[model samples]
Target: MSVWEFFVWFFWFYIVISCISIFIRVIIDVFRDPELSGWAKALWLLFLVFLPFLGAFIYVIVRGRDMGRRGMTASREAEERIDDDIRSAATSTSAVSDIETAKRLLDSGAVTPAEYDALKAKALRGTA
Candidate 1:
């Protein structure tokens, strides 16, 4: 093929890729929009399926701003949940290790039975 033909093919390939990317993003946004009711989501899907280019343009024009907000909110919520899980895991692991150490001390005759019981209670209470 000639250079011009190659360039044309490349341009069309890029356009098709861009269109597909936008279409997928729109579909995801439609589902992510919690404000839309079930019927509304169904209608939107139908519209996009039947009239892809027009539906995409209109959806962007009408609800484009909320899409970014929804994505950011989702990302923030996920991060917060991960942080909470990590914090809980760290505390629980430390509590378990503390109890194990206290048990070892008791076995070695370094602490009395009463002291070991107190330590176990403290660890279980998360005050270790």
Candidate 2:
């Protein structure tokens, strides 16, 4: 084939692949959405199966904005959950270590009983 014909075919191939990718992504997102009822999801899937191109096009046109918003919200919630978990773990470990160090210091006569008590309270309160 001529170089021009090859380029034409490659362009069409890219378009087709892009459409298919978008369709698959949308379908997955539909399934992932907790707000969509079972019947709604089933209807969407049926439409997509029966009329692939037009169904995908209309779905995008109608629900595209909400789809993007939901995706972003999900991502943000995941990040927040991860951050909370990290903070919880760090604080627990830090408090334990701090209390242990204070106990060691008290045993070695480096701190008075009053000082150890204060340090222990601070560690337990997670502010040490």
Candidate 3:
């Protein structure tokens, strides 16, 4: 195809993809909304299914701000869960490794028995 025809096809493709993305987002928001009862969700889904453009436009106009807020809250919650996982893994690994290193130091006479005991206790307490 000519370059102009290619550009036109590309433009249409992008528009279609954008619309689908927005539609999916709307659907997700509808379900994610705690205030919306099951019947309300069903009605919104039906409206969007039968009159996509108008339904999507009205949904956005009516609830766009709340949609954005819900998205941010979800993102924050996900980040917090990831951070908690990382912290748990780090603390567990560090405590074990720290105790191992202290044992090695004691065996090598680099640390006295008392120091090794203290290190082990600290590690077990998660303060190492």
Highest-scoring model, lDDT = 3
Ranking by TM-score: 3, 1, 2
What pairs collide in candidate 1?
A: none
TM-score, cand. 2? 0.68
> Residues 1-128, candidate 2, lDDT per residue (tens digit)?
99999999999999999988988988988897888999999999999999989988888899888889888998999999999999988756677788899999999999999999999998888762
Error of 2 at 17 (Å): 3.0
Please provide, for model 3 over 6-121, each residue's C-alpha lDDT reduced to its tens digit, 9 standing for 90 to 100.
99999999999999999999999999999999999999999999999999999999999999999999999999999999998875667788899999999999999999999999
Q: In model 1, what is the error at residue 3, expressed in angstroms?
A: 4.5
State the C-alpha lDDT per candidate.
Answer: 0.93, 0.91, 0.95
Model 2 weakest 10-residue run by lDDT: 88-97
**Clash list (residue pairs), candidate 3:** none
Q: Which candidate is the best by TM-score?
A: 3
Compose the digit string of candidate 1's lDDT tens values, residues 38-102.
99999999999999999999999999999889989999999999999999887566678889999
